[model samples]
Target: MHSLNVALGARSYPIIIGSRLLGDAQYLLPSIRGRQVCVVTNETVAPLYLARLLDGLPGFDKVDVVELPDGESYKTLNTVNRIFDVLLEKRHNRTTTLIALGGGVVGDMCGFAAACYQRGVDFIQVPTTLLALVDSSVGGKTGVNHPLGKNMIGAFYQPRLVLADTDTLATLPDREFSAGVAEVIKYGLICDAPFFHWLEANMDALLQRDAAILAYAVDRCCRDKAAVVASDERESGRRAILNFGHTFGHAIETVQGYGVWLHGEAVAAGMVLALELSLLCGSINNNLLERLRSLLRKARLPQRPPAEMTVVDFLQAMELDKKVVNGRLRLVVLKSLGEARVADDTPREKVIEALKNCGVR
Candidate 1:
């Protein structure tokens, strides 16, 4: 097992990454601080792994499982309320621990439920999907999506533990796995140039699901994200760098409708747009842009925004991004191959041009 700690002082927790960790009681039981436990998962995952997880928690006083309907479309307050309904019906107290046992959608809703239930409660993340293992399950960001924007209504509620069982990746579909690769590649683009180069060289091994390579990629992304989250827990400054392509990405999700494009798929295209904008703004050389584009192609990710989207659609959706300050749109763009900066000063014309360049009408 490869174990790492996210240092949050009193709220510090460990992330365990390894094979066949799902049914390991030693890992799961140690994280729970209370007798009562709730396991939140999705329909797709419950059939495959829920029994294994439940079997590990034999000592708990009470264990409840809420099998949520899966997918991005279900990431809403209404779905989250279902958790509350079950918790209340079962008379769960503040001491209850919520275990998110599925992918990003399940983790987000469970964490949100834990944060809001009885004011607050502990939660553990058992991210089954690659995206959750690498990104969403690590940071404290939790919330249901609002109709107006992605993650617009959420909380910075960190999980007590993040247990990523690489074994879970066995069942993930090819499309979903590639989506996770986008986030892995984001770390290299935003801050780790060598990792970027490494990915460029080893994209094939990763796509082939070479165990060691996949584990290393997951751990590297986690470490990068952990450091940033520790430094800017509330996204007051440096943390926003982590949203490198998310501004443009969220716009795609909002305009196209949630679940139509997976978050990672949208981010894949969004990163391309951000790269184009960076090139136009002279923040990065064309060589760097082309390199990322080539790397993305190797990963089978989108190289541009969706053809159906327009410049106006992007502008309108981005205006609703959380990064907007006093009506000015802010975007995270690359400063170099390995570094990023938040740019709110770019002229509106440049934004439109970048979108147009990427095939936005």
Candidate 2:
């Protein structure tokens, strides 16, 4: 197992990445400070790995499992309430810990529950999907999606530990696996140029599920994200760069309706638009844009926004993005392949032009 710390001082936590870690108490037991535990997962994952996880927490005074319905559409306050009902009925107190045991949707909701329940409580992240392990699980950003926006209603609650067992990914569907690759590609586009170039040459090995390459990619992303989170835990400054393609991506998610396009898939298409905007802004050339598109295509992710979406649809949804400060839209644009900066000065017309150029009509 390989371990790294987020370096948040008092809130610092370790992230452990390895194979077959789910059923190991040695890794999980040390993180839990309380005797009561709740394992939050989804119906799809419960059948496959829930028993293995439950087997590890043998001596807890109280242990419970909340199997949520699986899907992006189910990530909401209503679904989170189910966890509250169980915790309350079982008399779990403030010291109880929440163990998120599934994908991004499960991790987000469980983390949010731990943050809200009893004001606050400890929680651990055991991200099963590649998307969660590389992005959502490491960052302390936890919340459910609002009808108006994606993750607009969440909080910044760090986990006590993030235990990512690459073994869980064995059962991930091909489409879902491809979706995860989109975020992995994002790290290279925003900050890690060499990793991007490495991905260009090694994407085939990654697609084949080469264990070493996948673990390296996951570790690299986690380290990249951990540094950002430690510097700007609440996204008050440079942390916004992490949302490189997310402004346009979140717009696609809201317009297409949640679950229609997977978050990573939408972000893949959104990155294309962001790249086009960067090209028009004179920060990047056609060569860089094409290189990213080629990589995305090889990953089996979408290279364009959904056909039914319109320029107006995108604008309306984007206006609700959290980055909008003082009514001005702030977008993370690429200054170069390995550098990005937030630009509030981007003209509304320029955004529309980029949208039109990218087939948003």
lDDT score for candidate 1 against the true structure: 0.91
Candidate 1 local lDDT, residue 232: 83
- Candidate 2 positional error at 209, Å: 0.9
* Residue-by-residue lDDT tens digits, candidate 2, 1-361: 9999998889999999999888989999999998999999999999999999988788999999999999999999999999999999999999999999999999999999999999999999999999999999997889999888898787899999999999999999999999999999999999899999999999999988899999999999999899888989988888998998999999999888899999999999989999899888899999998999999999999999999999999999989888788888899899999888899988888999999998888
- Indicate the worst ten consecutive residues by lDDT in candidate 1: 287-296
Please, what is the whole-model Cα lDDT of each candidate in the order they appear? 0.91, 0.93
Clashing pairs in 2: none
How accurate locally is residue 273 in candidate 2, as Cα lDDT from 0 to 100? 91
Q: Candidate 2, which segments miss by more than 4 Å at Cα?
A: none
Stretches of candidate 1 exceeding 4 Å from the true structure: none
Which lDDT tens digits does candidate 1 get at residues 1-361? 9899888888889999899888889998888888999999999999999998887788888899898999998999999999999999988899999999998999999999999999999999999999999999998999989888999888989998999999899899999999999999999999899999999889999999999999999999999999888888889899999898999999999989999999999999999889999999997888887887887788788889888988889999999889999878888889899899988898889999999888788
What lDDT score is found at residue 43 in candidate 2? Answer: 98
